[model samples]
Each structure stands twice: as C-alpha cells, then as structure tokens.
Target chain A: MAEGKFTQETVSMTDAQKKAQRSRNIIIALVLAAFVVLLYFGTQAKLGANILQRPL
Target chain B: MSVEAIETKSDDVLISSAMPGDYYRLMKPRVMYLVIFTAFVGMLLAPANINPLLGFIAILCISIGAGASGSLNMWYDADIDAVMDRTAKRPVPTGAVTPDQALSFGIILSVFSVITLGLMVNWLSAFLLAFTIFFYAVIYTMWLKRSTPQNIVIGGAAGAFPPMIGWAAMTGSVTIESIVLFAIIFLWTPPHFWALALFRLKDYENASVPMLPNVAGERSTRNQILGYAVLLALSGILPAVLGFASIYYGVFSAALGARFLWLSFKVWKNGSENEHYGFEKKLFGFSIFYLFAIFAALGTEAVIMRVIG
Candidate 1:
C-alpha cells in the first residue's frame, strides 16, 4: 500500500536534531545508571553482607 | 503512482520523520514512569526473594510492556488524537511517526517484552504483561474508548494490572497483597480521569471519546467521582488492615484518603459546565501525588523492614 510506502522514506537529521538525539541518549544512560545504583543499594540492604551470594 | 503525485495528492503526507526522541515520546514516558513506580512497589511488597539482577530485568520488561501498550494505544487513537487539541501534536498525528511504523514498533515491543520476561523472570508475570497489552490496546483503546462512558472505569484494569504483574514476577503467583494494590489503583482511576475530563470536556467532546463528563453530565460525573474516592480511600487502607503495612502507613494513607475524598466533594459541589476553576485540576494533580505517595510509603516500609527484620 502507498501508506506503507510512505513510511519507508529515510530522514536526514539536522545538527540540532543530532544534538537533541545525543541528549536523549545521555538521559537514558543516566536513568539506567540510576536504576543500577538503586538495585545495588537495595540488594545490599536486603542481603546485608550476603549480597554477592549466588542465585539459589 | 508517482512520488510527485503522492506528495501533491494529500495535504497530510505521512512522512517518516521519527527521530529517537519521537520514538521515546511514542512510549508516553510520563505514564510509563508512573507504571514503573507502582510496579516497583509491587516488586518490593511481595514475600518472595527475588534476585537483584532478575528483579531489575523484570522491571525493565514491565516498563517496555507499558511502553508498548502506550504506542499501540496511540496508533489506534491517531484519528481522534489528530482532531483533539490535547493530542493533536502526538508523534503519529504530527507525522513524526507514521501509523504503520508505530503499530509495528508496538507489536514488536510487546512480543519482545513478553518473551524476554518469560525467559528471564517467570511466565506468570509475562502472561499478565501480554494480557495487559492486549486489554489496553484492543479492549480499551479500540473498543471501550469510543463506545462507552464507563470506558476508563472498566479499562482501568489494564493500568491496575502492572502492580499485580510485578508481584507475580516475584512470587510467581498473585496474592491478596497484590490484589489490594490493584484495587487501590482501579478505584482511583475513575475520579482521577473524570476530574481531568471535567476540565477538558471540550477536548473529549471534540474527539467524541465518550468520556464521563461528555456523556453523563457534570453532576453525575462529579457524584461518581465522590463515590469512587470513598472506595479508593478504603482500598488505600487495606494493606495495613491485612497486616502487611505498618500502623503509620495506615494512619498516613487514611489521612491522604480523607483529603482525596474532601477534594472529590469539592469537585462535586463546585464543578460546573461553564465555570472552569482550578478545583478539578487540583484534584487531578493531587490524585497523582496521592498514588505515588501511597505506593512510596508501602515500598519504603517494606524495604526498611527487609533491612531491619
């Protein structure tokens, strides 16, 4: 269908758009890092010194 | 058909202009955040011992599933979304993402999230996650949204399922605790959405979305909101009553419940078709906080108890 054909066109990103994309990637990376940090602390709190124990 | 012919034939040319940012927007990141938080609370409140890495993976899958549902909803609702001022600028409507692209993106993500969750975590939660997507995309977005005034009332079950899914991710089965969490969200959504509908009645009217205020009249909507708020307040206290949360949580949630009810009453008494004050908006905003704070209290207490006990 022409509708599907319409969606296949490639887009050229502008410099500003590239910058915005980079910023979004950075924010996503930061959020992932925060999640890892929270997970580490939570595991530590829950497991105490046994945090590194293997899965049962 | 020539490319030139295609370009000149329609004013609304469906171009593929979607950047990564537009893809992110397609996920409805704000709603995704709320889903993540509530699901995280479900993870915390469960009695099973989940490994840290697996828990993280489960939460990630849940987030992706939520995102998938949002994208699918946007894809299906693009018609009305283009017409309604509130949603006119959404990625699909604005042509940042074509409908086909959005639909493909959603389907792929939904399948990926479900399979990944099932393989990495447990199958029960994955099943719940898949059902949530189907319910939201098909039942709510495709059917209930345009057909019924009680759309959000029944469709709220989709949102309320995340916590239960998270709980299942941990325990591999649902429990009373998770059901209580589900009930709280399910009860809260009617008032939360109806209040927003009160303020944005024109938008719904224009979209022909059958939101409560547009269908039931403001008085009936407000009365229903008050009624739901009462049930929400009671549901908010069940964790403490069932012996999972602390008395402090009981007291805090009860107070929040009372405030929520009072605001609902204010909205009911003062809500008008012509006069647009901040009362309904205030209730809408507080409704967000009320959910977040209630879940936060529950999760924090559970975490502290895990550390201390």
Candidate 2:
C-alpha cells in the first residue's frame, strides 16, 4: 500500500512537470501562430484589388 | 523497491523522456500539416470529386509518411539537433526516445503509411510516397547531405513531389499544372532556406552539415538566393498563363513573388549581421506564407467554380 502511494506521488510529480512543459509550448506556439496570422492577412489586405475580383 | 525495478523505471524514463506530445514535435507535425493541406488542395482541384473518406485516407497516409520521414531525419540528425536551438528538443536529441526506438518507429511508420496509401488510394501515389521516403532517407540523408552544399536544393525534389502525388491520386496521371506546382516549390526552396542558413550559420557550422553558408560563403549563398527568387517569381506566372488558374491567382502570385524577390535582394545587398534590413526573419517566415497562399488560392478557386456550377 505504501509503495503504491509512493509511485502515485512520483507519477503526480511527472504529470506536473509535463503540464508545465505544455504551458511553455502553448505560449511559444501561440506567439508563432500569431505572427503567421498577421503576415497572411496583412499580405492579403495589401493585395485587396486582386482578391476583391467579382468575375472581372 | 528493488534495484532491478529502479533500473527498469530509469529505462522507461529514457525511452519516453519527453512524454507523448514530444512524438508530434519530433515528427514535425506542423510541416506535415502544411504539406498535407497543399496536397489536399491539389487533389480537390483535379477535375474530380473523390469519395471524401478515400480522400481523407490518402491525405492521412501522406501525412503519416511525411512524419515518418521527419522521425528518420531526427534519428539521423540527432547529433546536430542536440545543439541547434531550432530543433534541440526533438525526442531523440532530448533523450525522450532512444535512437533505436526512433529508427524502428520511423521504419514502421514508413511501411504502414505507404501500404495504407496504396490500398486506399491509387498505387501511383503509393509509389511516389515510397520514392519520397527513399529520396529523403537514403539519397539526401545518406549520400548528398554531408557531401554537397546543394543538399537542400537537390533534396527539395523529395518535398516538391507531394502535390504531384496528390494530383496523381485523383487523376491517375501527371499534368503540366501539377509539374508547374512542383517547379515553383523546387525553385523557391533555396532562397527560403538560405535566408535561415544565413541567420543560423554557426549552428550549422558546428554540426558540420556543409550547408551553403559554411561551404560556399554568405555572398554566394545570397546571390543564389537572389537567383532563385527571380526564378520563383517567373515560375509563379506559369499557372495563370497555362490556364490552370485565374487572373486573380496570377496577380496574387506576382505580389507575393515581388515581395519574395525584394527579401532576397535585401539578403543579397545587406550584410548578414545587419539588423537594419530585417531580411533574415522576413524571408524565412514569408516563404512559408508564400507557398501556402498560392496553394490556398488554387483550392479557393476550385471551390468557387464548384459552387457556381
């Protein structure tokens, strides 16, 4: 029973570490994703004339 | 706990050091997503409506195949990835996965993806999938990468094959339009990559991969980037001229191409260390958007036509 508890504690610590790492990853990914979004929409907006074509 | 059990736990830690999520990171899932998205667009535009299930199967297989290639790349390049900040935390390099495990995982994924694609999609796409794996794994990784500075340029062919494979999956034959898609990516790769090579010169040099920056010097690399930018700009016009795409695509391609050319010119004209130009990051990031937008345009046009009909 004590050994089970011990392993449970260890696993919890590992899970905590994993959660911390995931948070870091999400932040970095969001920053990069934001940059990509800006570049994509910014360029599209710049090419407004071509993109706004209505079969002409 | 006994000593043996402790050892076993340590081994477990070594085998999966970074957790399951690391698997996605190591496989370069984002890159695979972009490749699959473009390939899907190609398939959708190919004058047919494939069963959505079958189309999904083909795309998933291609994605897995792309991931398999990435796993193998990480396995082989672990030493270099260990140091490069851009790729340092890959499963193998970070000790989440052993080299042997990664090798086996990659091999298994390779076989599984190809067989699944062949049985679910067309055999032609299956064959192309197999060739892409071989070209990247054996030709690029084993032979050319260490030996030539033109590694990425030649190896770019492996990546450039995806849209063609997608078209073949739908139509069972290659066409001028598909080949032109291949050509645009083929020409764009060097300039896109060389810009990053300029920024990360030391990491590549430390890894001894003989990238253009290390072997040919920044000047030659920049000039090459400029040359490729010009070629890419020209190739961008072919889709519209050939009547495969609309004038809208042509206009957008021209704008994107002009911007790409300007970035290349900046990379060529300014010194590498100069932050005034903001050349390096702009080219690296914009190149990705350039390919995606072009492919996205193709997909959107096809959707518009389908709706109108």
CAPRI band of model 2? incorrect
Question: Candidate 1: which docking quality band?
Answer: incorrect
Runs off by more than 4 Å, candidate 2: A1-56, B1-18, B272-277
Listed in order, the DockQ scores are: 0.10, 0.03
* Candidate number achieving the greatest DockQ relative to the actual structure: 1
RMSD (CA, angstroms), candidate 1: 6.1
Error of 2 at B194 (Å): 0.2
Candidate 1 segments exceeding 4 Å error: A1-56, B1-15
Best by TM-score: 1
Among these predictions, the greatest lDDT belongs to: 1
lDDT of 2 by residue, B1-309 (tens): 775576456435421334456666767888798779878887877887776667776787788888888888888888888988888877887776668867877898899789867766778999999998889888888788889999999999888888888988888788898899889888978888888888888888888888998998988998899999999999988889999889998999999999999988888889756954378879999999999888898889888988996
Worst 10 residues of 1 chain B by lDDT: B9-18
Output the lDDT of residue B155, model 1: 96
